[model samples]
Target: QQQVKQSPQSLIVQKGGIPIINCAYENTAFDYFPWYQQFPGKGPALLIAIRPDVSEKKEGRFTISFNKSAKQFSLHIMDSQPGDSATYFCAASNSGYSTLTFGKGTMLLVSP
Candidate 1:
């Protein structure tokens, strides 16, 4: 199974602070990258993502920064709020089959 190493198993931030979660993978065949945000008692929802062709991508308050050379990527939640507290996951998959390998997960707590 492909593995994505994610840092900072957990994090805490004050309101309005940006919480960044980083992930690294060794596989180069992986082409599609995406981040998922899961709230308590709910399924994960796609946050933001970037392809190898793009250095970065942003959707609303969420941002994804990608580095093809390093085979790494990160997720940043801008202006984090208490309501934003949840578990974030980073995933990668090649175009073929769309099988995704996700990071263990990161628990984020945003304090008001």
Candidate 2:
């Protein structure tokens, strides 16, 4: 079973706009939720993360909203710029677990 489900296979936004990506997970054992951003020809890097204990987390222009009871999470990009265009992924993992399952991925395009 796919542990994570992400919505809006892709997105487009103008400069200064906000782009949102959503995700849902099926496994309650998932204790950690993280979002990754990847640019062309580069490896994906951790953008921000959240735990079941926190409802939300923010770092710079990226924010992660999590709902433990609903087993859902979403990422929002504030003041999106063309430079922010990239592929974003949502992932879930349990503490001490070696495996991290990721959502399909969302392609974000920020038009200048």
TM-score of each: 0.96, 0.96
TM-score of 1: 0.96
lDDT of 2 at 74: 97
**Candidate 2 C-alpha lDDT tens digits along 1-112:** 6479998899999999999999999989999899999999999999999999989999999999998888999999999989999999999999778789999999999999
**Clashing residue pairs for model 1:** none
In order, what lDDT does every prediction score? 0.92, 0.93
lDDT of 1 by residue, 1-112 (tens): 6889998899999999999999999889999999998998999998887899999898899989999999999998899999989999999999875689999999999999
